[model samples]
Target: MPQFVRKNGFWGVRVNWVEHLNKKTVYRRKYKQGFKTKREASMWANKFLAKANSGELVEQKIPTFPDYFMQWARIYRFTHITEVTKNRYIVTASHLESYFGSKPLNKITRSNYQEFLNEYSKDHAPSSVNKTKGLIKSCLDSAVADGLIRVNFSLGSQATGNKKKKLVVIYPNVEQIENILNLALERRKPYYPSFYIIITAILTGMRLAEICGLTWDRIDVENRTFKIDRAYNHLATDKEHIFKTLKNESSYRTIRVSHNLISVLSELKVNGSNLVFAEKNNPYKVPYSNGVKHPLKKIIKDLDYNLGDFHFHSLRHCHVALLHHDGIDWYSISKRLGHENLTTTLKTYAYLVEEDKIKSDDLIETQLDNFLTIGEKIGETSKKHKIK
Candidate 1:
């Protein structure tokens, strides 16, 4: 029998073992200490009994880090996470394997993990390092739960690198956006697919993959709305292109397009691949991101917007900013953007709200100044009429 005990602020277990050869002749008492909690001690005692009953209570051969993680990916990951997310996890794990894959799981102490992160941060950006650290921590957490390790060594490890100060969101103003679209339309004539893509991004605030995923069948000409059930997954290797899921559950939505925008799309509809922005040669396959970016980069450089750091996703930000500037509420904007929640919408677009507040303050000041001037004029009139 085993039971939990606490002594000197430490939790432990005391167990009584009967003699194997002569149970009635002798009994032995044993105690184990230094468990973090009573529940941990109980779990340890339970595992001891279970393993003993199975006739294998001694130390077993432990797998190396890479082997264990790959085992987890093959056995567990597919049943839980999305296929896209599982691929990302496997990719991140592969990067980790390049470093500590040869070491046994028990040998990977907290200090060793931290050292690995430090080495990784030298070449990678802080965000990449952080994402890698997060995935490592998640994998180690599963290891802990499986009783393969006593603790998750990768927990609470921060990426060490020269992190850049967060940049202010860069988005084109209304005039600049229009000019960029016109450039796309003017250059790529005949079908004008790029022009349609740009207009769709501006009006819908969709990600590049989502824009490329759009098809003529999803559009409702009479209702003037379209469904966003899935997105183009260009980066996947093991899976087919065009995953039947978007970035998240909230990303599945229906968005209304303006009548003019709908008319433009309808005019461009032709007997080709069902995808609205499919490649010219392979209509079934969406155009590569670089194909979209090359022409857009040229347009931005021609306009001299000094937004070399910006990418196609900047169009989504510009859409949010335009809505914020137009005095749209945060909730509606979140719904329109298909954000998971209002917090995400606010966090990403807080700068736009701040700019709006500044403009509001200026307008309020001007109104107060006019009121004071009117009050002064009324006072002067009263004085002249002796009606003080």
Candidate 2:
């Protein structure tokens, strides 16, 4: 190693070469900013020289993102799991796979990833898009960890109801919910399964898939409870949905059946059909021959209702809000909804609550005033007794 003196009187390891275009005297600056020793500076300079001479020659071969994803999924045990996760990931990878599957891992850009999210969220709910983005981001991050990509480009955060543009928050008042139900029943529509589905969800606060896969065997009529064990889902590559286990460990818990839901189930014909909702012989995910989409749409149209387009999930929101309004603790609600923790239940349903925030605030303010009055009385009594 040797030191070269520059025109500015700085000493460092340097490389001199002819300018490729002008054939002028040229110099290359190495890590002269930090390296105090010529030997230390020369080491990095030598590596840079090696990279320049042989790095391109050796070829910086790396697997494509899709290729890496396939490899990662291969090792991952996707089998023998809940169909809910399968379908969710399938939907998630669908957006990512179509976009970056062929591109080299290093070529994926943050802007390109953001575009996928922006476009998807335009039609679907922000929560749905964010869910898909989270899975994609996790996969791409794994690619970076595996050294298949230079950096993790995808950025994901949880879905906030206020932030999602495509989300349709059509919260009907209590009167409206009852009116929708009453109207659907009055229409005498035989094709609509969502009528019962919505009723049950509003009563129980179960997730959509849980309501769809409601089984007779899981129902304990004597115990007045029901267990959630399975769910329906589709993978990204899957053309059709399939039956799978419960969505998660939390989803496997049992719920105490409400009087309305229990009464609804008790009247239904429970035959060879293991499902409480679906009929026997031609059993389905959700009960009814007409399915939820068109049949439910017809029912809503007949009633001249667009706010009721939320389908079964809205009923879940209704259940949570109903409970929240009734002074139910979040822990109980979380358990009832099969959430892993209270926080998940809180974050997911915070937006679903009505803006009738006056009740909670007014109650707290009244309690605080009472507490202060009591404290003053106790202070006065203590002074009178000369015990303070």
Candidate 3:
């Protein structure tokens, strides 16, 4: 049986649940709120008891999809996840909320979810659609664990994400690299630090976040090495950004730098601030990604490099490409880039590896041709000596 209660200008229903577990009876009372009127509450209570008696009531209550996801994020995710990750999750939630705001978590069946994804796929990329589905599945997995839902219905979607063969790796050649360095030294841009940032990234292959988070204390001038242990989360101009943990374990590593870079760094004043690339006025803080991007674009335009869609990250790719061209081993490049796995380096620079293989083949063919010519000359001498 169930009972109706009224409080805080709202009506609620209280129902009892009993379960038999290993011959032991477990009893619990579940309460649900948000009824508009007492009669509505009474009707719900009656309906709940009937369902419970018939063994059709599985969960205590079903929450609206948006409401549950929002609550879950606030309670379980906000503190544990990184700021960037939290923002991504929030974006996913907002998109899902628009579609399933009023629907209960338990009511979203597999067919319903599949249909939703099918519609979402029409407007979004396969990767994005899959990412959204992944997030929803994660949220629903927690719901299943809490006994809030009988099963995660966000599973078994037939729409699959496209497999990415390789990431696009673009970088400047030797002549271009030299030209960039010369340009940086030659030009005095309005954004003073952009050139320095570009040069450092080309030399070190550090990510934009790592560059923003770099501090002088982490740099060893004598050893010619810099440690990358964290990344910066640039939220706003007025608000102070935070230095958070590195992307992964491998991202925290020490990379050797050049003596030329060392000399340049030494010339720059440490400026009462720890950040090497900190803004002029706010010496304690580094510029945001946009701050780096705008200057980089301007420099590319000024130099007339003819590089399309070139950004700060392009410098990192350029660094990797130069190293590969200089015959640096895959393992060494992976370590220098602070990649968690060598596979990442191998996959990223596969085109470079293919080029190296072609060179090797050419060298082998040239040696084989020389050996055959020598053999032919020996045979000709033998025949002439026999004839004499």
Candidate 4:
């Protein structure tokens, strides 16, 4: 219902409605003024009431950016995301708070959001900027659906960063890889688990988290295979070494192991712990990925290989390079690496694949040269017989 009133020289109308907020019913009212005639005011009130009755009106109470982001993330993202990923969201919320500072969600315009992104990107990497932009966009999109705002400010915003690009994927050459493996095998001691971890990484191409989370049950000595179904969450605050699901469905795979690797693993004495690479004293706990890097750096230093900025993850790339050198197809390599698809493998190792192509071209040319030589010899023999 509407109440008609006269104020000064114009007609006005007031409409009342009821809405549910926080599981409680609340009354709301809106007033329209400056109508020339009572009939005009009545028509406007009718349209407003119809919209309100149909639940098409936008929400009146809008939350700040940080408030809505935290709310949305807890409801939709917190359950499925890993501890590290949740930490990233928390950091994003912190940034929103620092930048927006109690600004209402609907008040954030496109230009305002873009300016924030541009400013944030000045110090962050492009990837980091893009991730933040994506997160904010997702949150604002939900806000739009909830009728908190009419548009997502982050929709058309560009992520620009002046941070230096990351270095190219650096993997050791074949000789360097062999030297590294030999050195690791020689220096391997019960106290040093990095050696074994490095060997496993080179052979299996498993991510560091996967290797840390690996249990004895996952390894099948008889079948010479290991299953990757879980990863260790080193970032988990609730537990020292929490096991979580793999990165994606593709990460849950079984990879074949060589006999030498099986021998090395079988020789490892498991001290009542199911973990293959448990901590020296605490069998229940696993070594952090960073802990594995110190000894690796020492090994690289000893080997005197000029591989720039090599780390444990470089072994995974080394494994891919080995596979490519052995003439394995991209699809097989993809499966071995447990990639989501072949495209990921190809994209990551496109340069190495191109190098392999050049080698293949040379091999083909050598075979053609041998064929030509054989044909020329046969032609000479036939001509000599005809002359005789």
Candidate 5:
């Protein structure tokens, strides 16, 4: 029989192996998890006994890190998460297969993980390497939950300590955005859901998937608002499109349509059943998934928008940037952009570094006008004194 008891500030695992011939042997090791109540300790005791009796107790060494990671992906990840998310997990795992595949679960060390980060992630930005570390750590943590390993050995790795990712934060100014929008509107060739999808996306910082999910049913013409209840995801073409809740509960809020967006939707008012951005002629069609060619990038090139660092996601960035230029605070912008926190909004749209300098220069021009007017008045007074 295995049992649990509190010793000093910890709950300990206690096991008694029954000898069929005569005596019994008891072994115990205390873990540092402080149980607030006796019930929890009792529960641990019951579970320990069950595992010991079934011979399912976690051994000191059972599987290699490589072996356990694959098992974790199948047993824990695939059934629980979104398909797109599951695929991403698989992709993250696949990249790791080359490095830690043969290493034993019990043997992976801090130095080896450090070597991987220093040798590989040093060239990459701090943030990208940080994401890689999280995914890999999550895989290993699941292995810990599965009892394949006792402790998370990579806890102190350099990648885990990376402060933040250094993403390129170059958003277009107002004139640049207008130029891009006008350019997008000029495209009548492929019949982009230009009138609805492209305009809304460029104006509102909602994700590409969220724009694809917009339906006429959810639109409010009278109030000129749109609800974002969910985001449409079709990350792969080989599979069916996926429907998931908005980025989070906070993302489910309503967003006011811009005047231009309202007018465009008015122009797009066909008696449609499903999507505002649905395929025009084929009323029954679903929109393109992630694998399909996103025409925004191509349109930029066709229009000769020799703009620098302009990606589709930049349209979202531009939305937040324009609001920032209009003097919206980070908290308000964070809500509108469906960010979980202000920190995220700052990370994404905090590129207004030279704002004060630009404003100062503009202010100097206005002050110069006032200064010149004073000089004219002073000269008139001097002339009047001379006349006197």
Candidate 6:
């Protein structure tokens, strides 16, 4: 029971408890004054004692928003996430520091967070704003779990940003793709690995990181297939040419290659190096994906293809387009491209699918018309025979 007393013309309460510190028992007391009546003091003491007995009372100092966020990320996110993902968290921390400078995590209200996002969206793209918001929301969720904040202020917050239309997907046509492939094949040499990487990407529809991490052991020349299990971490800070697991389980797949592609890969393989796209002079190192862009641009210019913003990733899109042209289904294309689901392939190549649908509709109409015309001719011939 708490002891009640009257001091300085106000009622007060004193609560006592026993605590253990470093294997030593210690007695602790808490005092609260300025209550108007003994009943009020008694009520407050009961609540405080209940919290203390239940072990819910925490007396640690609260950290600022940015400080807590950085600490949370270091403990929970740094080791598990990629270098690029870590940079995004760091950037979000910087933004929090700029907006909430020295503000306690619990002191920031939902309105304050919404205002910050509103200001941030004025100059950033919608996608960028959304990413930042998502990162902060995750951090705030951890804060709530840690008993640092009562609520996640970012919940139900709306992110609005500069409205810029996304660019259309432009891939190379059949003639242009053939020209690019031929040029890459002619320029490919033992010392130049970009051309080889280009050819592999076009044939396999592999991401740049996957092609860079490809090894000779993963390829089966007899079966004409290669397995994708890992990828090169290009922008990693800890180590160069480090191999990392694929993005997801769907990304781990076996791709069948044509005989000609197998022949090309065989010719490029070196006796000592296991990597298929190793560096020029050093067989142990892999070339960066950016290294392929210059040569790819040159090829496009030489072929006079009018593709805008053409880059290394365009090869993957070109592969999809070629498969679509060959009358392959979306599910097959999705699997070939290592997509997580058929919906991803459909959404990404919706224009191509729409075009195919239009062509199919026209063919269906034409075939039906021909069949009805033939039926009418047969009916007229049968009527004439009956009259005779």
Off by over 4 Å in 6: 1-12, 16-29, 33-47, 53-55, 59-62, 68-80, 141-151, 165-169, 235-241, 371-388
- TM for every model, in the order presented, reads 0.74, 0.63, 0.73, 0.80, 0.67, 0.81
Q: Please, what is the whole-model Cα lDDT of each candidate in the order they appear?
A: 0.75, 0.63, 0.77, 0.85, 0.66, 0.84
| Candidate 3 Cα deviation (angstroms), residue 206 | 0.8
Q: Write the per-residue lDDT of candidate 6 for residues 152-231, one digit (tens) a residue.
A: 98999997787663234467777778788899999988677888889988878899889988888999888999889999
lDDT, ranked from best to worst: 4, 6, 3, 1, 5, 2
Segments of candidate 4 deviating more than 4 angstroms: 1-20, 23-59, 163-165, 235-241, 361-388
Candidate 1 Cα lDDT to native: 0.75
Candidate 3, residues 1-388, lDDT tens digits: the string is 5677889999988888786556777786789899999888888778877777776654356788877887788888787677778887788777778887788787888888888777676666666777788778888888999777898887677665443522333456777877776777665332366667777888889998898778788889889999899776676445355677787788989999998886675544544566777766677567667766786777677777777657777787788888887889889999989898999988877777788899999999999999999999999999989954
Return whichever of 2 and 3 wins on lDDT. Answer: 3
Better of 1 and 6 by TM-score: 6
TM-score of 5: 0.67
User: In TM-score terms, which candidate is top?
Assistant: 6
Arrange candidates by TM-score, descending.
Answer: 6, 4, 1, 3, 5, 2
Candidate 2 off by > 4 Å: 1-61, 70-74, 77-101, 107-133, 153-165, 184-194, 232-243, 270-272, 288-290, 298-309, 352-357, 367-388
The clash numbers for all candidates, in the given order, read: 0, 2, 0, 0, 2, 0
lDDT of 6: 0.84
Model 2 score (lDDT) = 0.63
Pairs that collide, model 4: none
Q: What is the Å distance of residue 210 in model 4 from its true position?
A: 1.7
On lDDT, who's better, 1 or 5?
A: 1
When 4 and 6 are scored with TM-score, the better candidate is 6
Summarize candidate 2's per-residue lDDT along 17-123 as a digit string, tens digits.
Answer: 22232444444434343555556667766776675454332334677665666566545636654544566765655666776667777876777766656666666
Misplaced by over 4 Å in model 3 are 1-59, 70-81, 160-170, 188-191, 236-241, 364-388
